[model samples]
Target: MFEDAFKLKIRPDGLEKAAARTYVTAVRDVLEKIHRTACGKALLQSIRFHGYVVNIIPYPGADVCGADVDGDYDAATGIVMPTVRYTPGNFAKGGSCSHLPGRGWAESILFHELVHALRDIAQGKRRVYKGVVMTGGLHRYDTFEEFIAVLCEDIYVSERGNPHRLLGDHRGIAPLDPALADSFRFFATGSQTFRFVERFCRENPGFTKMLSRVPARFNPIAAYYKDPRKAQSFSNSPAAHERDADGVWGKLFERERSPTLPTGSPANLPPPRPASTPIRRP
Candidate 1:
C-alpha cells in the first residue's frame, strides 16, 4: 500500500528521466524501511486510510527543489509535488542536502513531506497551538507543524545511522538565531530529544520571539481565529485546544501508541491516481 500511495514520474528529457528513476528507487527503499518501524507503520496506515496519494514530478530549472500545492489535506485528498530538476549540484545547493550524504537529501525531503501528510490527517482543520491556528490552512515553515516534521525527518535520518545529519536540511528555513540553531543541534544530538522541545519552548524566549516575527500571511489562523466568536466555535478555549494539540504530538512522538489502523484490507485502499501528463514549456 505504501508503494502504491507514492508515485514518481519525470519529464521526458533524458537527464530528468534518469534522475527521476534514481530518486524513485531511493525513495522506495526509504519508505520500505519506514514501513518496518512502529511509528512509520502508523503514519503509513494513516496516509492510506486518508486516501492520500503523493504524485512527484521533476521539472528542470525550478527555483525550489520541491514544492506542494495548497489543499494537500483539504478534504483528505492527496498531495501534488512538482520537484526541481534533480542534479547533484542542485541537491547540494538546495539546503535540504546540506546534512544529508549522497542521496539521503532526496530521501529526507520525501520523508519530510510524508510527515506533513501524516500530520495533516491527524491534526485536521481545527488544530490550534499556543494561539497559532491552522484552520483552513497549511503550516508555515516556522510553525510547530514544521518543527514536528523536521524532527521526524531527523529521527528517520538518525535511525538510518547518521544521527549527526539531523536538521541539516532545516537550517535553510529555520530562523538564523545562533542560539536556536545550537538548540536544535543539541536536541538532535541529545538522548532526551522530545523532552528538549517541550523544555526549550518554555525556557527560550527566542522561540516565541521568532515565531512572532513570521509574517501574518504565512499563518492561516492568525486572522480568522482572532475573532472571539470564531475561536470559541472551534474550541472551548485556546488553552484547551493547545493542550489537545500537544497530546496529539505526544502520541506521534511515542512509537508504542498506535492509532488503530483504519478498518479493511489493503485491497480496499484506493488505487493510485493516474500519473500527470508532462507538458513541454518553452
Candidate 2:
C-alpha cells in the first residue's frame, strides 16, 4: 500500500547506491508514519489521486536542498512531480553530515519537500507559476508556504523527541513573527495547519493581496479554509482564537507546547534577489 502511494526515483548519478538506499528507507519510514496517522491518511489519498512522484537527484552545486518543481504540477491530469535533490558535496564521503549523520540531512530535505507536495495536493489542480518574479511580488505567500512546511517538520520532529533531526531552517527565509507562529501552531495539527494559514491570509491584506494575484483555485488559503472539516477542526481545539477570552490574538500564542529548534541554513542558498511581476494564471 505504501509502495503504491509513493514512488521513489533516484537519478543514476545521484547519491551512491548505499546512500540512496538509506535515504529511500528513511523516506519510506516517514511516509509509513504519515499513512498510519488520521490526517496523514487524507493527505496520502490526495497524493495518490495526483500521482505525485518523489525524485531524488544530485544538486548541481546549488545551495538549495530541495524544491517542489512547481512547473511539474499538471492540473489537467492532476499529477504533481516533486523532487528532493541533494548537495552531494555537502555530505561526508559516507553520506553523513557533520551536524547530522547518515541520511539525516537528506531525510530532512525529503520531509520538507513532502510537506510541499501535500500542500499542492490539498490545493487541488491550480495553475502554479514559479521563478523570482512571482515569489518576489508575493513574498508573504512564499514565506507562509515555508512557514507551514517548517512548522509541520517541527511538529513531526517533536513527536519523535529528536531535535537534531529537524529539517530546513526557516530563521532567515521564512521567519514568521514569533508570536504569530506560536498562535497558529497552537491552532491546528497536521494537515489542519492549512486551515489556520488560510484564515491568517484572510485577516492580513498583505497576504490576501499576494494570494489574489494567483488564480482562485491556487490560492491555498481561500480554498482549504472552505473545507467543511475546517470549522469542525477549529471548534474541537482549545487553541482556536475564537475560543479565547483574551482580546489579543497573541494571547493564543501562549498555548503552543512545543517550540521549534534551529535547523541551520538551507542548501542551495540563493542570494536574496527581488523582482516585480504579477503572478499569472495558466
Best by TM-score: 2
TM-score of each: 0.42, 0.46
lDDT by residue (tens digit), candidate 1, 75-139: 33333222323333334445533433334554556556666554454344224223232211111
Model 1 regions lying over 4 Å from their true place: 5-30, 36-39, 59-61, 64-103, 125-141, 173-282
lDDT of 1 at 216: 24
What is the lDDT of every predicted structure here? 0.40, 0.41
Checking candidate 2 for backbone clashes, the offending pairs are 62-268, 63-267, 63-268, 63-269, 64-267, 64-268
lDDT (Cα, tens digit) per residue for candidate 2, span 1-282: 355545545453556778767655555565565555333443345455555565655555333332333425665676455655444334334432333332333334445556666555444444333322112112223355565566455444433344343332343233333323332333332233444455445434342333333332122333333453553464346543332332122222322311331243222123422222111101
Candidate 1 TM-score, C-alpha based: 0.42
Lowest lDDT sum, 10 consecutive residues, model 2, at 273-282
